[model samples]
Target chain A: MNGDDLFSGELENVMRWLSTAGIVFALISAGLIAFFLTRRPGWRMTPPAKWLLLVGFFLLPSTTMLLGNVVGFHRVKTSCAECHVMDPWISDLRDPKSTTLAAKHYQNRWINENPCYTCHTGYGLAGNLEAKWSGLRHVWHYYVAGVPEEIKMKRPLPVKTCLHCHAQAASYLKIEQHVDPEMEPQILSGELSCFECHASPHPRKNR
Target chain B: MSDPSPPEAKPAPAEPRRSILALTIACVLALVGLAVTVLHLAWPSPLMFTLFMVVGQGSFAAAMAVYLAVILVDLRRRKVL
Candidate 1:
């Protein structure tokens, strides 16, 4: 179970480091810049000050922000819930009595950490990149174009999203329909979407 | 074209007022970004995350652009480029 808690503790440590060292470094750089501003110009600026401005102020903080966003922020459930549109789905995912596939996984801890991201994001590097790209597009929609009333996937759900795990599982392999030559190609080609058989993963109301 | 006006030697390099201001602004932008990013990391939210993604990263970009312009101008003026 300790290994399962990887998302729980390691993220806290990252947060603590960023809030402490990260904030302090930026503040210190700001103070130094202010101090340098008061001094007479010309050749008064020492090389050290320039290096501090370049590295301490700019380089470190930018890298830290990128790291913070990708590593830890994406793992938390509320990170997605932060957008009001996702509230209904997050609530359903948490509801003990909810019969949704997502809720069952959540209650059972089948995916452990970041069940939302895990299910939504497909497997592998391309999938990860696509997820991040979609994330950016979501922000653009939320702010510039306005969010749609009923959220819908722009494309057919990738069967790989479900198959990456399920394909090897005994429950899935044992099913005659899954291994049937007739059904297998349809599933693989995504002509037959996984959820078509499994039904709704989340309720209709995203809220 | 033969009027003999003296070519005065370059005056003492004046203080880099513009570059200093640029760096100052850069500092402010970066600080605000760092703060918002930290806040979001502490408590997750779409609002804060959006700010972090937009304002926070936006400030960094603005700051970097200013820094770049300042550096280029300074280098050109000094004939170092």
Candidate 2:
């Protein structure tokens, strides 16, 4: 009963619906374009023909393409696991005995859904897009330079990623280390990492 | 009298080549979007995810631009601009 399971199941249904619509519209649109492409545009430039083109080319495909990303990208962890390099991290997440921050959060259900994306996306309204674009960069790197043998984090873990959830928590505020005025600004300003005090975010066994 | 007033082939349409080019490009872009969308849905990997999000949405936008251009040109020809 992982939260991701429930959310992912819902997204799966939506994705199926969207993909079906995308395929249908794409077929119709392409077929209609071909229809007009081969024949005389002047001869068939009727209002109905125009309507067909509008629906086929503009309306349907636009909706389908937009929704496709939503239903498709919403399930980031599932998508992340597709690459072989991610297998160990994903395995650690699922391992009951693993003590890494990611594993603890997963096992404890601290993150209700999209645990992978939520933790890694840093913080912003565009955080999702940032993460996705970063993923694209990863894809480019994987195909080009390949994952470094160590598969290290590309950037420092954003403090805001932790603050996004924990900053306002009563338990988080009550922590003795957090109350230290000298360290508070450093944490907020990204000078110090929470992991230094807490623990490393992930296991260091990447290969 | 050797073939007085000989026949001649009809002239082609005066419309520009880019009109057709735009239509063709739109179709191709749509097909690519469709293929990429399906691939993402099928696999849902980061590569496909990026493609669907970027290439897929981008294809639709570019296709719309070209298709809209074609429509605008037609409208202007009819003096509706």
Candidate 3:
């Protein structure tokens, strides 16, 4: 099913309109800023509407973010057949790298069985809007605070996010066999998350 | 040639009071913006939350640059270079 077919006419229209609006808003905002920079004289607006326009300026981006979240949530929840046909982007997860990364959900079994959301929920959930406290806070910790280089060479394991799912299958992993004898203390104490030995599910290029 | 002053031995630069004032105002705005943003991130404040809900996409850094650019142009016109 094409995306057009997957979504009802109204929903598809709204999605299209939203995506287009986001692009246009981004472009227009960038362009206006550029124009204001090059031209010394500022564009004058009527005093009464100026505040309203400023308010609107801020609202547009936030609205786009919300709309994007809604559409993205919908896209992921749809069936596999709908995914392959409607959104090829979702299907691209079948690629080897994505497959391998996703496989770490289980120790050895590499199967494309679970829908992406089954294990990974609560992302972008319009709540927990703190800097070090949001839903994405865990990711920031993993990338910036949690993983230490010294521990990585000494022992390989997954990060905290990995353990969120792997905790259930802890018995499957022969922990002692996988972890170095030296680092057993940390591993056994739950101090070291799994991503220590296993590579990060999502690795950044530049640290 | 009056010991042709070494290029590196130039007189110390003077601070522009006008520029300083503009910068002070800019810094205040930026701090307020950052505080609101941080609050919005942590525990959302209604006013700040509303502010962020709008204009969240426009880069604050870019806005700062624009604000500074305007001030710089004004300073130049005032022969403060």
In terms of DockQ, the best-performing candidate is 2
Candidate 1 lDDT over A24-51, as tens digits, reads 6555655655665566554334576777
Query: In terms of lDDT, which candidate is strongest?
Result: 2
Worst 10 residues of 2 chain A by lDDT: A36-45
Comparing 2 with 3 on lDDT, the higher-scoring candidate is: 2
- lDDT for residue B17 in candidate 3, whole number 0-100: 39
Q: For model 2, which pairs clash?
A: none
Identify the runs in model 3 with alpha carbons over 4 angstroms from their true place: A1-18, A27-45, A49-52, A61-156, A159-162, A170-207, B1-60, B64-81
DockQ of each: 0.32, 0.36, 0.03
For model 2, the superposed segments whose C-alpha errors exceed 4 Å read A1-9, B1-13, B16-18
Q: Candidate 2 on A92-116: residue-level lDDT in tens?
A: 8898888889989989999987788
Q: Which portions of model 1 show Cα errors greater than 4 Å?
A: A1-9, A43-48, A70-72, A75-78, A82-87, A94-97, A129-151, A205-207, B1-18, B41-43, B76-80
lDDT values for all models: 0.72, 0.75, 0.42
Select the stronger candidate by TM-score from 2 and 3: 2
Weakest 10 consecutive residues of candidate 1 chain A by summed lDDT: A70-79
